[model samples]
Target: MRVPVSSKIGVSNPYRSWKSATDPSPGNYSMGVDPNGGQQIVIWGKEGRRWRSGQWNLQFFIGIPYMSNNVSSFHGFKISLPDETGTMYITYKPPTQDLFRFVISWEGKERQLKWDDDKKKWLPLQSEPDPDNKCELYNYCGNYATCDRSNSRRICNCLEGFKPKFKDQWDQENWSAGCERKIQLQCQSTNRTSRENGKPDGFKKLKCTKLPDLATLLPSEENTEACGKRCLENCQCKAYAFVTGIRCMVWTGDLIDMQHFQQFQQAGNFLFFYRLHHSELDGGRKISNLVIVIICVVVASFLVASLWLLWRYKKKVKVSSMPCCKDKDVAIFDVSKSKRKEFSADLSGPSDILIDENQDNGPELPIFNFGVVAAATKNFYEGNKLGQGGFGAVYKGELPGGKEIAVKRLSGNSGQGLEEFKTEIILIARLQHRNLVRLLGCSIQGEEKLLIYEYMPNKSLDNLLFDATKKAELGWRSRLDIIEGIARGLLYLHRDSRLRIIHRDLKASNILLDAEMNPKISDFGMARMFQGNQNEANTVRVVGTYGYMSPEYAMEGLFSVKSDVYSFGVLLLEIVSGQRNTTFRSSDHTSLLSYAWRLWSEDKAMDLVDPSIRDTCSPNEVLKCIHIGMLCVQDSAVHRPTMAAVVLLLESETPTLPMPTKPTYTFLRSAIEEEYIGDAQEIVSSNDLTVTLQY
Candidate 1:
């Protein structure tokens, strides 16, 4: 069945029916490249062409949308042209040196399979025309229609601005007749010169879509806008799209074989479909503007009334009755006469008081005196120094009542400045949870900005988890409790709290431990609040420690709750193995995640438990935790479980956990340190290295 280098290999109708297990005869189906040098690989049925592998685009077969450059990188797929001998061939170099083959079965299913050493059988890596989504069968929806597998009722649907050509057939679940444009294109009747006189057509942006078949690449146009103008000038142009690698692509005929993907499923490509009329866009814009105007008026009126009420209340209230004045244990002062004058001269403002008062309707934080804080810390001496963080040096301080506190004194040269200080106040002041650090109050005078928090006697989890001598204190049960506590805190931030939050810098050191050894998540500097149901966001300035950051957040500046989940996964693995994800190395495994994954795949997951806790650790519990950790570190953010799911899996034994894929292995300690260390300053020195960048 091997075709010569210069010859064509194909399947024909008569060869497809040979069903004998040991039969050397061909079946009723035939497949091969067209000998006329069309480059497309076609499978022929008894009737006509059944399927096709669209012309090669150097990296992949254009017909298969998911066969991307990454697939080539993983499988080493390539199409080689013939030499003077006049032959061409398709080949692949497997990721591993495993026995492999490409075959077309009796059912006409083309598949690429590899021998599975463990299973002792051939396992198909890829099969053409997925059975579940029959839309992949070429032009399943016919002309001017798109196919979406996510659509439950029917896989085929008319493209936007179109309607089914045959309404009866559409209702009957027959889409062979496809669809037609609802409004006639303006260019149909008007000439290019006359088109400028009336409302011109425009493009409707289709986010994350597979472009239709028969796309013409416009190389002369450097950008999309230019290509758009070119398409608009042409009377027959139906659609256009701007692709990163291919640049401008235009379609003149009906759009076919189109597919739409959700935001999470999309790689990078999008299709900009042309609209037949300007009214299609104008109607939506008008409604949006009206809504904006109404919202503005309501918000403005509410703000004015609120301000008037506050002003009237302030006139009748006495300063002696203020909450800050009533608390005897808390001291409020301006620190020094010079600092008071400076604060009054520059920083004192009504907005500051308003923000502090309105934050989640929480209690107003008492402003501490700089002098009193300095005295408690012995004039900010080195002896009282507890630790240094991204913000500045933290010192151990005791109030007059012998109440201990950790004072985070902001440094002028530190990456975290007044903005982060305010963020910490707004977030921590309102959050009240057992596993969350408590912010007592803050002090702002002259150039000093400090945050006071209830001191944790045992310091942070990293202090115990990574220290060989101290790690033994954390038995299996204790570590499991710590993991559960952290999960609860994260769950609260993501779902239970009034405001959804993403703790971008979740890590071992940021998790503080109380005297009872309960884990408390600290450091709200990099936390982001998501209003309503907003789950993810993007930022150009990425802030967080290396090793603990998720792949999306680290490489693309995209983050969500799943980002925190990824960090938690790394932390969980570290807690179980008593090893640092970034620093741990062995003869066979370069990183802790790699090592854990190897052990899991080899059914040696119990071996990953730390020797200190091995005697007490339950084999099933440890294995389950490892499995959950691996799920959390999956490459795709969508694949990572929500914090709620993680918590349930940890607490209940009723739910069966899904199998985890291999963890993303892009991170290597040496390479990451070399690339990022020079650009960032070391903030916290512990078992884990935390770095912060000055923007």
Candidate 2:
């Protein structure tokens, strides 16, 4: 198969399948770069992630150990991440490029075919998931569990010092939850109330295997010893692996998608160390009966004393800051009674498709009582209100510590705000990024649902981007920084974070600005989660603003990461041109997109720059952003570039980027206001479920 390659994502990177066996249409499968970008590839199916090509070890995909046995020149496959000088590309040369064919089959399998002139047909040379071993499937053994096909009867097994999370499920051959530690570590962890033990943690080494997915790249280490030492010192680090091409990589949280390999136990062939309790590393030592009895007696006495203290503490906590029901969704925390209030969620719900995600995510979210929130916002005085939007009104407040906070108060009457309130509480609490707004905590009392965030002194992007007096304060360079920040945040949502998120509503109003004028993407209530390798999903009830919605999502309720990209493109153009997507009107164009495209086609792209920064803006930088924005707002989702690509445009290996086709023309604001409502108030009402569609 012939394919164009690049180190950067998006352009000439992905290979998608036909709709069906005979019908030629786009299917739900694609072979593309790994979203996590660990120098590997991933194949996504209609369901989720189907398979991965393992990690790159300079020679080949380390996951494909058998590749070492093949002496064919097929090893010409090479990939390099783009650098400042544009030295990035992914190139592959088969023995006969013209005769070889590559395809993502309609049946959701990636295939490499060789044309046989003798037989007058194409012959398949390779396929993923191995077909023969069901264990090859993605996360078949779940977290902290490895699938070993060598064990025909039971392929799934937990590592030493671990046991199945759910014994009943494991007994029934369901290892999705995988395993849990048999004993607690000395340092801080979910199960541990605090750092109690004095002993240090240790590591257990394993032989060749596919490294766990989503490994975060770390700085270069002199050797595996240094890598191990660095990971071992960090409390969050769970495992560490060192590869040839890619140096040190450390995995935090639960490790998933690990497999067993038969490669020889050598220096660089997939030897990874998993973290465990130091006691678990004892070399099968036996203790004397008398010594064991003495230790047991001492531990019993300590437990008795600890239990009494724990009971008294729980009694005080249960009186106020906890929920009445074990499976309750809301907790009436009384922050006024204490400086810190704890979250009471014995349940999970649908935000990014999983509620209360993990121990590291849920319990960590703080809870502010209604009394404290009310006092901070001066009983929600009219003057304290920052702004009112689809979700509700945001109020500026301050804690007793003099820390500023922005409280998003869900409208009691608007049923729409309730879901959004819960969503923001779940999604933002788990997400950690500078470009993304930080969610401090939540407040729930009776009908009040309030989400507390670190207050942005400069307010939202729309506050300055559209304000006549404040617009010029953000220069051309600052505007570019805002664009890049938003892109980074969007990229994190889609590819970097553990959760694959799609922000359905991404616009100027939703972009918040810090005191430093740095941009942070906010308002995740309309966001949805994409599980595993899931590319797209359909919904009947559509949400979000009109002009920002993607064509497919607005008309058919189909949404994905690309939907956010389209919205971002619109926002990007607005940042550059200082014009709203829906309100722009020119002599020959009705919307901002059409006007920008018209200028670009006429070689007057410079005319699209916002008047305020035109004098100070670098023409080259401005032109590059406009071109990228045009690519993002493409009418067809297939043609739209991924956020990862947009973020990496600076490092593009090619000197000249591809020219973007004419974008899908946006709506005429005059017609919208005439047909729907007279003002912006009615269009973006407090009830967020307002869906305006064309055709």
lDDT of each: 0.71, 0.75
Pairs in steric clash, model 2: 1-100, 1-101, 1-102, 19-25, 48-533, 49-533, 349-355
The best candidate in terms of TM-score: 2
TM-score of each: 0.48, 0.52
Best by lDDT: 2
Estimate the overall C-alpha local distance difference test score of candidate 2: 0.75
Query: Listing every candidate in turn, what is its Cα RMSD in Å to the true structure after a full C-alpha superposition?
Result: 22.3, 16.0
User: Which digits, one per residue and each the tens of the lDDT, describe model 2 over residues 1-695?
Assistant: 33333435433436877765555667767886653536666778868888776776666776665564452545678765656754455567776655776677765666777888889999877533365465667888989999888887678999888999999568646578899999877786554544554557889998867788888887568678899988988989999988777788899878888888655534345578999887788663478999999999999999998788766675344323333324222233433223332333422434346523433234245577677788789999999999987557999997665668999988866545555666666678789887998887887677788889889889999888888888998888699889998999999999989877888889998899887777889988877877767899998778877777888887788998899999998899999998887666556655678788888889999899989988657677788888888889888899998988888893352336687876644534435454565333334422336454565
> Candidate 2: where are CA atoms >4 Å away?
1-308, 318-347, 355-363, 651-655, 665-695
Per-residue lDDT of model 1, residues 202-306, tens digit only: 777775455666667776788888888989889788888766545677888888766655342233443566656665554634567889999999999999998
**Cand. 1 TM to true fold:** 0.48
Worst 10 residues of 1 by lDDT: 315-324
